[model samples]
Target: MQLKNILFTSLLVSALTYSAKAQFVGDALTFSQENNGGTARFKGLGNAKTALGGDISSITGNPAGLGFFRQSDISVTANYLNANNKGTYFGTNTTKNKGRVGIENAGVVFYFPTNEGYHGWQNFNVGISYENTNTFTNNVRYEGVNPNNTIVQRYSDLMENPQNGAWGDKLFKTVLVEESLDPKNGYFPVVGEAVNKNQVSDILTTGYNSRTALAFGANYNNKLYIGGNIGFTAFRYDTSQQFSEGGWTKNRAEILAKNPNSTIADPTHDDYKYVEANYELLDDYSQRTEGSGIDFKIGAIYKPTTDWNIGATITSPTWLTVDDYTSSYIRVDYYDKETDAKPFITKEVLTDPTEDSYRLITPWKFSVGLSKFFSRGLLSADVEYVDYSTNKLRTIGGSNRSREKAWDQDMKDSYKAVVNVRVGGEILLTNTVSARAGFNYFGNPYKNADNKQYSGSLGLGFKLSQNVYMDLAVVHLVNDYKVSPYAIDENHWKSQSPVADIKHQRTNAVLTLGAKF
Candidate 1:
């Protein structure tokens, strides 16, 4: 390869707006956080456990609830996760579904049975747990033709306004195109019309958010429960994408009809009689993010009667530092205008990898719950509110302070507060078996849109022997959003780019085995 072409390959890779991120611009807040991760019973009960205690998983939310346990127990949950993401670009629609396995929750709780009659302190409990809270494994494919514009303009604009703020125009000339100055457009460069072409993209996303926690709590007079948890959280996220645009733009059938004597005889751009050349773009980009953090939680439950209980909890924002890495490859079918044909393939892999470190402060949340027990059944409900807008991003260096502040301000402007609600009920089916049902509502984080998620859950529990049991639960989630195949960032904002609509759905099934001593 020529030296200039090699430089072009490297510069163009850096010039594109693509980044290696665990969190994309649209799903960052939602993807970085975890959902409630616990036992099958906890999930089966809609995770409305603030006031309903007695399960080992409850320690994750409010350690005080663990006070309800009178026996020491251990549990492990296995899960099956399936996600289907659909997208529509222009008028074509495509869907991709992916399936995988995960361990959602596993933990143990120890209860010190107390006979202390003095101060009504019934018992003391301590627990430690590890749970997988959120997942990012998914796939989406969208394909269509964009008739209004070409990525050539995007390349030209990048050359005009370089990212480093110097010699961008000079560097642009080396790798991308031979630019001819135009009065109105500044630099005019076109391999061809890039119309009547094909556009396609396939992306795979994968990751997980998990946490390990230690909790302690005590029960007072069998009427009150108080507990707290010290937690450490970590996550890994990655996205790999393959996108292509353009092919043969014009056909010969329509050309010969216009000029009967004109000798354009075939559909391929190889015909020398054709006035314009043809080109294609095939590119791949992939990025990964890994992070670890810490946080704290405190909660309490008050039971005035044996059958009724009320509870509330406060969760502190997590302080996290994240590391990101990214790399890319590009291939172009260069069109020779003089010959009116594609001469050769220009392919280059940007082997240079980029890395960045940043700090993040997640949102603080508050929750309240109410539970009622009956002779044959029980009902529980919880309400939780989080301010998504409170999420902030900061670069590590003093010189990057302004960049971090700008990003933080942008997050505040783009996001809003959301309230999530969970409700569940249990119906006794037999002496040793019970049936459970629940519902949950997660408010949309985007303030300008009405996108929300609703989930329904069903579960069953059985007691196989005196100290052993099993629980099975299933939950379904659905939501809708939009994405784009490519952005016209250099010339026009993404809002001006073609919009692709998407609807995503997932199902999680979990089974928990437990033994009590």
Candidate 2:
């Protein structure tokens, strides 16, 4: 084989190994962040904006909203959130109680007039801004006996009783030797044994994402609006596992039959027992899954009268190409299963790890919002829909798991169009201060899955100057879901692991500081 071919093969193998260890689904790359008062207004109406203005964060929801801006604007925001996650496997508890924290968005925009002085067109506006769509961190614990009890016990029993025709007994014969025997045995004899018991494990994951977008738009005779944005996204993720994995026979039984410091009279002191070994595998997978993509948005606001306005927008999906890297390490040790006693031992460590890369296609989204003006205030609403079923994971190299995940029934299931409804209005309490409130409802994305969510919000905005204003919003989110595994144990012929149900509640808060010129 050529040297280059061998190197390429090794690299592919490493990539596949890394991909196998990072297997997981639904790390949703979509935004879960809501503008402080977005949910409240969203609930009252929905994102049906005939006139888009005020909040810059709303640009992603309705770029036409930018057409409402009379001048250039910039805004920075921060948010905090708490989540509860749970999982159940075949009526058995698998994982539960997960939480996380993260940052949402910060960016600026410059709105340009036609540059030719808005002659033929009513108004020409172009701008730039940044936003965050997804933030996550979760930890789960699964215990209550390793599900493969039958197979494991068989391996253990064979080791304990060498005469038993089991795989462990066969393995014991292959490695045992005469030179390893103790003086008491007439002939040098090496012994081996196996044991089986419960195996408990813990899994953890941490992730975050933020994006920078350059946006531009225009308004024609205050009646029609159109715009587009090119966004660059940054993504980070890490996953790890801790498990008890060393009880297979051959090795454990030998430790029991050996009375290294004792004579035949003290044989009773040396006994055979199952060895419980625990090891922690740490995988630090950190990389930038970045790609630049363009999204086009066109909207129109038709005003039949001065007080009422109707609007709508169609947003193209942002197609992105992602690249990622990962690394891992493992350590192991043994203890007496029954007595909880640690035998004199040293830890085994594996530091070098394999690395790999892969790609993912997140789905496209669609939304629309509308608003109406009254004597003292104005009311607005918006609606959004997304097709998550089209999302997919692509394997770039040597892994079979990716192939398996591709053909897996769970991955094949189609997700429903998730819906978001929102309603909001502003009341002028005074010349410079305005009050706002809104509500929003988001339908679950899973097709036959459970986990529905809703939110409510309120806020206050004060204009410091003609081109500057500060707004503070308080939002509350009520989220609930059902988490169940597709299958419980592989050996169950007729008993497939039924999806068990689990529910969770989450809450978050957001604040935005902005300026318009």
Candidate 3:
């Protein structure tokens, strides 16, 4: 029993639902799911600023933190980021790494102290800030040998299936086929048997998710602070993939060169010693997305005393409008000893410059935090939850409404809610210097545990002057996941062929400068 034949007998449930809908894969990964980008201080402390309010970043996490301010302040942050991906495929392993720099955060806050006549109000503040929330810059490459079967078997299966029209189907119409072997059924991949084939795939991605926010807040006496913010968000994600497979070719120039006179009909190569191998469908595919949206944030901070604090925040789903473009091409190679055909070459554009527009409703989020204040610093922790399944996809101008509806249902069926936790603390080592550390845990969005992310951070702050400060921070993250290059309903190794186990490591260094007036 051939491997491809066995695949047909056992189609896993996950494979069955892989792409019966509209999108192919990794569609939802484009969203900013863990938007924690902020000032060096915030990131250094695991971004757990909910109840330990007072910094510029706190304005977005919990606007009420803005009300805790008593001075006009401005700050800017820059970050250097590096990512590495290690992949293990059928007995082979590979690794790739990339690095870049960007402005992580910049913002200004204005404060207004209430007059003495205002007994309950302590201060009012307004803020404007920008943050790079998510990054998608990574390079991953994986390769391995597959003696079981080849991609050509997929094309053969497509033709053998009754659903894909008759012998004169679209795929059958291609010139790369041997119809004589099965005139009634379909065509064969090669004139002879195939063996010793291997597959290599590469995936490259780059882009970002950013947000600009305008916020307002006020302090009530010495106990409560409340605020709201309006945020504008934008995202861009670009990715490309290249996959190649090679193996059996009697006329494979290598073999043909040795046996210059051997015909395609020659099976055992009585005249030739070794024939060069051949591969089909060396292909490249690319996709890009540009989008923008608006979202709202409201939050409150309660301080019963100077020693204890509690905070809560709510964020509405972002309504994003996006434009997607994709292109792809494939090259197939073959050689025929008969009909005087030599190294047949043909290229086809599988996808043109296709454009698509759609709306995405991101999930709503809720967060809560607690803090304990000391004479020198504070310790804080936060917990957040968002139902990723609520992420929805709608049709454009009612185009393909029914089909999109089904896709949305699939999104809900495949996704679930996630819980993220963060903890951090700052300690004033001296009157002019401070130290900070934090840890964050992000639950996996997938049903399996292989995709979760964990981050740890360390930082330092220097009080340059009474009104000037500088902060430095470093964060490290690790992710373990699986990437599938392609998943047809039935690639005998459909369960394994395109799937690669990937281990990813990311590091970031941020420096922030701030001024208080």
Off by over 4 Å in 2: 1-51, 84-103, 111-120, 138-204, 241-272, 275-296, 326-334, 337-354, 394-411, 484-487, 490-504
Q: Please, what are the lDDT tens digits per residue for candidate 3 over residues 1-517?
A: 1122111111111122222233422365448485599999988899998886678897678999999888999999999999988888777999999999999999999999988555799898999999999998988888887665565545554455564443224444343333433344344444223455678787788999999999988899878999999999999988787777755554555333333333433556432222333435575667788899999999999988789999999999998888877765556564333233455544343434567788787889999999998999889999999888778776666678886777667666566788999999999999999999999998776543247579999999999999999999999998777665544334332433445678889999999999999
TM-scores, in order shown?
0.85, 0.65, 0.84
**Model 3 — which ten-residue stretch has the worst lDDT?**
5-14
Give a tens-digit lDDT track for model 1, residues 284-344: 7777878889999999999889999999999998888888777766666645453555455
Return whichever of 1 and 2 wins on lDDT: 1
lDDT of 2 by residue, 392-429 (tens): 55555436675647523434463556777777787889
Clash count of each predicted structure: 2, 38, 4
Model 1 bad stretches (over 4 Å): 1-31, 164-180, 187-194, 248-275, 334-343, 347-351, 397-399, 448-450, 489-496
Supply candidate 3's per-residue lDDT for 108: 92
- Candidates 2 and 3: which is better by lDDT? 3
